[model samples]
Target: MSEVVETTDCTNGTTTTYDVVVEDARIVTPNEVVRGSVAVDDGRIVAVETGEFDADGDTHIDADGRVLMPGLIDLHGDDIEQHLYPRSNAAVDPPMALASADRANISSGITTKFHAIAFEDNPEKDRSPELAMDLVESIRSNDSLLADHRIHARCEITDAPCIDAVEEVLVNDAASLVSVMSHVPGKGQFRNIEKFREYYENDANLSVEEADELIEERISLTEAELSTRIDRIVTAARDSGVVVASHDDETPVEVERLDDRGIDISEYPITLDAAQRARDLGMFTAMGAPNLVRGGSQWGNLATEEAIEEDVADALLADYHPPSLLAAPFVDTGETLSTRVARVTKNPADAVGLTDRGRVKEGARADLILVDPEPTPVVEHALVDGEPVYKAEAPR
Candidate 1:
């Protein structure tokens, strides 16, 4: 946990004046939104009210009715390491990747993120096990990285060569979440052979001959062997006290099995049946916020907005896009913006067991964003742990 800052001076007999007073801001908490003033003493929220506030200190900001809420938490976004370093054959500077990704998250209002690094030892893809390890090492050593970056090891269960590498990540890095993804042929995400073929062919830039050979080579794991491997990984993860998530669960059976095995989060459940089952089993149904903002899934998975409207989905990941997290509320869900905003803020924090920082309340960490909302949604200011990390350039 980070230290909270404190100050002296208060309005209405409050104990101290806030370090900064965001006056007349549209404050959105989990319960409600208020047209009021927020008092920040040190780096904690000391006062939040709907009425007028007397001047306590010199520092103040006028939000002009833009939405003010907790910073968005991205549960599973691959925008950083994977997208930035697409080729295992090529090496990009790790510090550049970290700094660039942090700025990208700040622009998206994602103050906290679990940078998804897929565990793969393939020589063809640029993402070698060694490179992945280096990426984690580089980010963990740097304290000046913009967002509160955490790790999410997207462990590919079929990658036997990378099992030790996954274990290394768990032991060495701050892996907040571990997701089990099985991409073997005729199972998991590649359940349909044609669809699977299309994905590998079009997405991976693999020739038809190469794709066929790769599919044939994936036959090393028998069904029983695959099941055993998954169990071993899940057991190791649970023993380490890491949050475990099941990826792309496609059916009620899949949900039930994962739920029985103590999986706490379901990432992108492929069907309504699986999503609903996860919700009923007290597991969070993590959908892509991009799906909500885009009005549907990009590749035809379950739409997040529909799941939210139906009360089946509990949280949203930025998935591949960081900007979608902040843009999700403005997607016109017919409900008030306050209500829609909770899906990205309060719901996700709760889903991931982060209780103290999600709402604008007394004593909560001042993880906040000021949105400039006339021409576009611009993040005018951002704070993490009560310190201003991002402030927009003043107009000339």
Candidate 2:
């Protein structure tokens, strides 16, 4: 499947070349999966041809007849926060948490991840604007990160003080995506008031009465300043060439409103009607992969499988779990493998304006993952920009 080809190094007057050629694998492209070999030179895919490559250099990954697909692009994931706070009161160092998340992501086949950091004022814990800014800076400055780290700032519409913080990231070009969200009990992710109360009590340590009062307060505050703040945040993000999303859209009217405001994506629409409306309005509808894997929503919203069946869901996010992205694609979605894979790969990449590295093609950045798609889907190796960042020691 692989052969050695020598070339002269003129400067040293000797034969030397170390290009990598991955051969004898089924490479999944944007169009179709073909049995081929891919040649990489300087972190770019130079060739994708049938059968084996007659030339090779330093490394030749045989792939052992596994599936070689483009590395996943997670649009919205909060797994970093989970690593940052493994327990309710336990907190780890930001860099250490981020490093741990990076290993998990790459091993799960995610080569590019947008770490969803919320810039909000919450009574529960320390998701302060200052912390968000610091985390963003940490992610941006950490060159040792294996995955391509980026920020997705979830701006709480009712948190008026967070506007300046969100704006700072956009103006400074630190955020790749921004989503406007409202967590009032009667709307968004808390459509079921009981679920909202449960989360408030458990996560925020609020009593029943206190949770009710905070919900009412949030509703009033959101109603008073939603329009103006939404406009300001959306305008700033768009001006910075960052993609904007509407989070937890609950109805068709809400989708229409966000569509009018030039939202590029609708994240986790709570109902089938909302998801359909989002697609009809030409906005990409993203549902959590965990919903599909768990067979339903944890907070009692529309099931992702139902949304996929209705052909309304266009993209999938890791949401709170990074491994869900790898597992969700293998579920029986009544679609081709390429189509299901695109929900995590090309769809999210295109929605977030990443024009390269989502598909296996000539001239694209060689961000790829090799998987064993059998009894259980497993990520065998993860490569970012033609370099192997994670490789499984055994079948997993």
Candidate 3:
């Protein structure tokens, strides 16, 4: 339990007060870890001291050397879809699923989440055009939540018909980020056509013939039509100040074309050459935190560790797993803890044009988490905008 407290400085005949103070923490900075305490007031960090705060804070905690780091900013996570459709064919109310998604993310120390919703032409519950529209509207309207929620509308260029819905979301301010994706039989993440068939059949619950026919539909999409659709998306996004990203850049040429189209973020570059090209072209390259945590890519593409080692990976997202985002900073990538933390924090914030709330410095937003790294870096406490949002309860 925490209570408000005040202390008097008799020498100066004055009192110093802070809204919150966390002491004895191994604070993570951008370059180095410092053993110190942090003071917060009015939703911002006001001071960081080498030792304990000389003045008392109203709400105080003894961190006991736990790791205090900035709250994670996840640019791509579809974990909410997991809650929205908990079962294979069952559906839950959007509000209930949203509440579940909020708790899961806050507990995992993700403060800024760009919830990914696919506006593709699909039949699945979560990715269907109907569901995506509903979700974007639902998430944009819902107000009560612990973590920050924004929409990342994923548009499949192969399905040119959905451009209307994509543009609608952009025009209506439902989605702030748009990703251009193409999952044709022999391109992007589905380049391994056989694996694509298997995965597609499983996800859509289709037989071999049905899946192949669907792939044929994607393959039949004319390049000119797809190019026109991409232009429409890029132009709308640019006019609306929405960030646009390229998905699964598999080659240097692919990276170049997207860069020329003004796509600034490369999400999940499948090869080292592509990731390197994105970096050279000044685009932020994002890989999945799950890939880094699990030591390899699920699709056997460019390994997350390999990208990190090559200094081409600038940010990490949760991809399909929220918990992996919290664990990614602890992975050993031959970088200092501070730099590793940057993969999820400062770098991500910068990638999205957010100039604040990603580092432990004075004048930064007090979006922070205390992690007990004994077992696997569990979040013990989380503060968003200087307010306690989550605290782990332990058995007495």
Candidate 4:
């Protein structure tokens, strides 16, 4: 583990003041916030102090009395998939889709993102494995996007027939996080018949007749069948050393079973009990950023703010909206802006085992965002590892 180092050398000794100076901004770190000038050299924060200073750099940004903080680390988001297939029946260019997704990501100050691509074995949502593989290749090949994008594969274990697809993604090293999901209608997270009905019948763009058929298919799975598939996927996760997360756990019993399988992350535990169990078991608890932004869960599950208040939630993921990760908590929590920012930045980074980034501290990776805090606090600029990726247009 690389320890964080502090740098305090000033232009008092050398002719060069600093490589890059971000001044006139409110800087938010993990523990505190200060109106300061943050200097960057060799892509690491060198100094953070209040007061203007002469600086020399290939680039400089005047934050204009706005907020400067660590770029958000989004652990789960489906915005990329939405870009690839904007409409239910349409397919966009894979590379273009990724580029568009990255641009959207930066607009919200997310410097690092784990794109959760669902491996849907269901005929309606499953893209061809070849197409999925191509998209992953595009993301890896083109890393000069607005944010650092990694792959998080959502493997529907109940779709046991499609295990080959999951294995292929992992073997190709396209998957960074693996989540086991099951859509069996009668049980598991979607146990509420009305919730399942609303999702497939209306939200999924399926005709009522077609939705009925899909529901029937899901309801056909027996406990024995589901258990067998779960065992197989859990075994695969263990062997690969892939970070395994459980999705939408609703009960303590469900969390206990997930814990027994060596799961380290609990993605959206539906109930307070399940979330509490996850926290006690030392699993990283991830809630949707949208939930916090929207003020409640759309499906009537655990509210993100309530979860945070209870201290059951450890990380906030931008489940669908990338920007919500930047905006939601700021409004929900009464904490100083800096503290709200840490929940999205440092907290998630620490949970996912990416400690090098997240905080705006010396020796940390220069994944930072500078925003004008206007037009609903737009992301005026974005930087990753001291490299500029996006700069918003000047106001009219």
Q: Ten-residue segment with the worst summed lDDT in candidate 3?
A: 121-130
Task: Kindly report which residue stretches of model 4 are placed more than 4 angstroms away from their true locations once superposed.
Answer: 1-13, 126-130, 207-209
lDDT of 1 by residue, 175-205 (tens): 7778888776676567777777787777666
**CA displacement after TM-score superposition, residue 5 of candidate 2 (Å):** 8.2
Q: Which prediction has the highest lDDT against the true structure?
A: 3
The best candidate in terms of TM-score: 3
Output the better candidate (2/4) by TM-score: 2
Look at candidate 1 and give me any clashing residue pairs: 9-16, 9-17, 18-40, 19-40, 87-126, 88-126
- List model 4 lDDT by residue over 1-396, tens digit each: 122234344745555545567888888877787887788777788887776655645567777778889988998898887899898768888888998998898888888889887776544663545555677788889955868889887777656545667777777667778887887675656787767777777667677788778788877888677666667666776667667788999889889988887788999988899999999988989999889888899878899999988988777899889878888646747667766787788988886678999999998988888876655667887778877778885865
Candidate 1 clash total? 6
- For 1-396, candidate 2 gives per-residue lDDT tens digits of 134456675656775444677788888888888898887777878888887556566567788778989899998998888888888668898999999999999988999999999998773655788878878988988999899999999998878889889998999999999999888776778877787888889887888898888877886774537878989999999899999999999999989988988898999999999999998889999999999999999877889999999999998999988888998888998888889888999989888878787888888888888888777778887779877678784733
Clashing pairs in model 3, backbone N/Cα/C closer than 3 A = none
lDDT by residue (39-141, candidate 3, tens digit) is 8887899998877567678777788889999999999999988899898678898889988999999888899989888877767434677788888878888
**Candidate 2 lDDT:** 0.86
Worst 10 contiguous positions by lDDT, candidate 1: 1-10
Instruction: Kindly report which residue stretches of model 2 are placed more than 4 angstroms away from their true locations once superposed.
Output: 1-18, 222-224
Number of colliding residue pairs in each model: 6, 0, 0, 0
Q: TM-score of every model?
A: 0.90, 0.93, 0.96, 0.91
